[model samples]
Target: MTFRSPFAIPRQLLTGTTSLGGRSAISTRLRCNQRGLATVVPPVTQDATGSKGPTAMVFMNMGGPSTTDEVEDFLSRLFADGDLIPLGRLQSYLGPLIARRRTSKIQKQYADIGGGSPIRKWSEYQCAEMCKLLDKMSPETAPHKPYVAFRYAAPLTETMYEQLFADGFGKGKGGRAVAFTQYPQYSCSTTGSSLNELWKWRNRLEGKRANGGSEPAGTIQWSVIDRWPSHSGLVEAFAQNIEAQLKTYPEEKRDEVVLLFSAHSLPMSVVNRGDPYPAEVAATVHAVMQRLRFKNPYRLCWQSQVGPSAWLGAQTSDTVQEYVKRGQTDLILVPIAFTSDHIETLYELDQEVIHEANNPGVKRAESLNGNPVFIQALADIAHDHLQKGELCSRQMTLRCQGCTSERCLGQKKFFAGQEQASMVI
Candidate 1:
């Protein structure tokens, strides 16, 4: 069966499509021969002596604190990020103040959820397992080395980058790395922010000169798998989990159960900027429903909106409360956006939302942490990306309609220009 990507762009239109000052913005850095095609080094499938081992597979996500003790630091870093929170000139002052004020309460939330978030544990496991599969599925890029780069919390992006250098990846030795976003849907505040951070470090550590000079000859070649909202395997995993939850209800009430597809909410400011998250998230929900053959009624709702800003809604908690009050208590809350269990799932959905409803009829489907099906899906996504040798999805080349940040522009140019650096067998 042919699967269509919701963010799909035709291959022919990808190159020379985006421009700045009437010149191709992306391919400017690419080394093209007389024939006008990107010239790359020989593909690293395998040497005659042995396998082409140790391909770096970096999993990128906005991580949570592993213990209550780490909550303050986590919140501080989170609030400090202009990309995620955007506090203007007072960001340095207000970010720490906001974090300090909220730390105690947030710490308690972490305590309530068995000391802290389980994201770190699950992310490491998922990446490692996926790499094990990649070693077999794509032997050309065999011995895929798993690495996790969280935007906030321990094992942060900088720390992960340092490890890559220590592991003999980029200190004047050419290698390949793929930045695989853990978020299935793309969001500037999420995946885009992570990519920006990654690019920042690559420039800082890899000797990109102050005057915008290029890196050393033998540095790491980078590519990204930015978004995969409607992959068949991912849809199947979500559908199976929802079905398992539905089976707990009696046959008479099963068909009547409502599917509440919930994702972390984005601020209206970001939404107005033309962020692709909302549309991509809806794609995941629609694909899952199709996989289930539209067995029951469903609605996509938003959750985990922070601060006083107007956010995307009907909010998940409010949606659950109103439905229970209306005597439609049979509902299944599916966390569609997050691949692994975190505060949103364990504390917010379970502890706060469902607990407040006080109805057993209201339930949450299991998170996709350590689910073999989901892990296999991750491996499948990675294998396909490695085989294709595209720098990133064509969708990544186009910035948000209202984007003005130079960081976003530079990051896009650097990654998109990597067509020349990419290995094609």
Candidate 2:
């Protein structure tokens, strides 16, 4: 999915000048209608003389939509990835006119929900909560440091790395080293993007040279925490959410509800290229649903597709419509991809699906937001990863002792070159 940008540049970035709040004021002054986001400085750090500075933990992930104007930018970023879509001649066929027209409707969806996308907010909350959990369970030492660096937005990896370096994450946050990125689930798209960025950052730091015609940069001692698909606790959390949400409906409706599991859709051609995103989510969904063991029928489908490209088959809307055509009333739409309730599960499922599933006969369960069980599961999974050599399901470890790493970034051999700009210096 395309991620929206609230501004030309996020204000939290560490501009080279050390004047306190210098760039921030300039950014705000230069703002216009297009730079529509507020500029708020995050918490800062201090030195021996108590000079205030920055802190780090900029976790990175692809952002979701934020504003109407951002819809196209998000789509461009989404479709730009060959692993996400195969535009073919469709772009030329549909052309910019059609692309804009189609994307306008999608942007309105975000505008309706407040102005910006909720992924950034939800991720920040998750990062904070994850840090809190780590502090509680293990003091004096922490699990891998937590940060939220958006692949498409701020805190961008370079920006956050700069912020953390300034703040003391890695010789930046009080001179203590910082460790970023350890997403529980492994996917080339998510973990892959994070790993490549960190490696580039490290190259710039250590001054490692890029192979091919790429750039040279130092590197960060980033632990490549691979995706953990079968984390039983996390899987069980989904199971519990299904059961909890199902309780809202009477037993009769519960028995008939469709166990619809939804993940962000990728292009059909990209899926053909061996992107395991769909398969990874599916495996997790199946394992979780089996644990839940409801008598209802379930199906996996994709959502938030854009551009003229053909995405995975049976879009959520179409699938829901089909179910309604078949006379099903109660429908439980589980967000297997996201662990929290963001715009997708909220607006998409709530307004869009509720509207599309117009069968006066249909009903949907809200996404499993940061519910108690879900948060607990997240904390437990991280804890399990610490105890076991690899990630452990609530009940068992998914990886054997032989399998130490959590990801498979080199599976396809797509390499990234070092990219360090003077703006960061």
Candidate 3:
């Protein structure tokens, strides 16, 4: 959760930088020892001018452990975040104790999924695929280099930024940077935390450079894709995934299969503070349901509740039990919030939740892991946003009126400022 380094280094450190090659050098200099992950050195490809394109696409999300030994560290880092646990000034003191207490249980869960989460692999693949798709679908940004940064694990945000800065990011020659949150729905605890961490790091580098330090001085044009809960392409992807999963049941039983949309739960304390996560989640579910022309019974439930605090619910387990009691045993549980297959989807839904259900007919939809349709949807969303060069379409950019978190509010103002800057130019 914490790293120590000065904000600036020598100008020679960044001279003659290229995309994948620059990253390999930075990784070597840092001596990255993350779960055997080496720098992904991409082959050189350039435009007609023989120069890499100016645009870079960065994807941000919560990272998972690649092995059993890292489970404790991942959870500890997650709990240590004040945005997640809200332990006030005592977070530093109590977070470690809490993580240690839960390690054994969480480790067991990770073991069920091959001793670690495959999230890193899946995310990296998604990044690589997106790079190819964007080049083909949005050639204006061709020669795009992709980077993935995690909030709680390796390939940490600061290191990814160092690679970008090395490649002349935020420098005029680099052209532009577009950051897209992998979380479909926005939450102060997740995407907000990642963005805040990024800016904090970027600011430190910039402040030091402004005072005649070594960080790159020319600023890159930056944009963000903050939230897209109801994006048409995304909605269609979910609808298609759910419909495909439901077809596994017999035709007659299919009508009886309840569509259970489940998302990771948030503490009510965060909700009462006007985080807007719950509402955004609902928006995604509603949009997906509408896309399916869903007439069958459906309900939104929460999963992955940790610690004994009130969480956003109708918990997924309790709901299944209640449905079983009512003799509605047929079900299709869709992980509406998650895009990748991780512990929450693989272990929680497949094993723990299913074990609690008395209905043998209950089934779950697979997470959208490397689905070509879904990946194309992601590409389409980014292509459109980049073409317009806006944070989002005005409709897609709407915020929760009740959200009062400074981070959420700041995102709104930041995008508005970008639009105004465009006007002045």
Give the TM-score of each candidate.
0.86, 0.69, 0.82
Candidate 2 local Cα displacement, residue 293, angstroms: 2.2
Worst 10 residues of 2 by lDDT: 19-28
Model 3: CA > 4 A from native:
1-39, 43-52, 168-173, 208-216, 391-425
Backbone clashes counted, model 3:
2
Q: Give the poorly placed runs of model 2, Cα more than 4 Å off.
A: 1-58, 65-76, 79-83, 86-103, 143-145, 171-185, 201-206, 209-219, 307-310, 386-425
Per-residue lDDT of model 3, residues 1-425, tens digit only: 00000111122221211111011123511221234355553433223364336567878899888787886677667766766556555555555655676677777777877988888777777766777888988776776777778877667777777777665565334356777889988887887778777666666554423332233545555577877888887787788888888888888887778999999888898788667678889999998888778766899998766544577888887888888889888888999988899877787788767767846788888788878878887888788877886754353244444555565455444444444423211
Candidate 1 vs. truth: CA RMSD? 12.1
By summed lDDT, which 10 consecutive residues of candidate 3 come out lowest?
1-10
Q: What ranking emerges by lDDT with the best candidate at the front?
A: 1, 3, 2
Best by lDDT: 1
Model 1 clash pairs?
none
C-alpha lDDT score of every prediction, in listed order: 0.80, 0.52, 0.69
Candidate 2 residue lDDT tens string, 321-381: 7777877767878878775665677677777786767765455555545555655665665
Candidate 1, residues 1-425: lDDT per residue as tens digits? 11111111223222221111111111111122324354331223323355455688999999999899888778777766778776566666666566677777778778888998888888887887898889889987776877788888667777777767766677776678899999999999999989988998888778663444465776888889999999999999999999999999999999899999999888899999999999999999999999998989999998876555577998898899999999999999999999999888887888878888899999999999889999999999998898887888888888888899888887887887644323211
Global CA lDDT computed for model 2? 0.52
